[model samples]
Target: MEIIRINERPQQVTPRGVKARAVLDVPYINIMNLTLAPGDEVPSHTTPVDVLFHIIEGEGSVTVGPETAKVSAGEIVVSPAGIPHALAANAGTHFSVLVIKTPNPKNMAKSG
Candidate 1:
């Protein structure tokens, strides 16, 4: 059995947000610890793999497709493939998001 620790992976920063510790990855699924600090946002983009984001801590807003909703700790949202989505953190908010991506599609790419 392979054990992956969430705190072991180095944090990476993009123009949009930060990703830390890819906890699990396999042929069919991938999981990661995602964070968007206050005033930070993941720009509107679409991916080929279906994604589910579970807010583990703090408050934020997520725009999925054409809809936007306030999100708080314990809330979860799923974005289907090809749907445009973005996430923004409220002032003073530090959110911990657990992302689950399914299918492990070979064509998965971040929209430029």
Candidate 2:
């Protein structure tokens, strides 16, 4: 078993609008801690791996495929591989998100 401390991980800029910390990355899964402040946006992008997002705090708008929804704390959203997805945080709001990527493709390279 492995354990990770979210606060201890260093943040990395992802997609120009969000900061993320890699929590745990195994052969079959990758977990990250994400934070987006007000006016911050995660640009639309797709990955080969399925992703699940758990909103730990605050509220935001999420665009998944052709649908957009307002998500709040405690909400969860899942996006399948190859679908486009993005997230926008409301002004003055701060949100923490947990992103879980599973069954990562064998061809993808892991970050150093």
**Candidate No. with top TM-score:** 2
Looking at model 1, residue 12 earns an lDDT score of 80
- Candidate 2 on 1-112: residue-level lDDT in tens? 7667789899888866579998887788888888998878888888887888889888898888999999999999999998999888888899788888887554365542
Candidate-wise lDDT, in order: 0.81, 0.84
| Candidate 1: regions farther than 4 A off | 1-4, 15-17, 106-112
Runs in model 2 deviating more than 4 A are 105-112
Q: Could you tell me how far off, in angstroms, the CA of residue 41 lies in candidate 2 after the best superposition?
A: 0.4
Query: For residues 1-112, could you state the per-residue lDDT of candidate 1 as single tens digits?
Result: 8766666777787555475667677777888788888877778898787989899889998888999999999999999988998888888988788878896654244322
Error of 1 at 53 (Å): 0.6
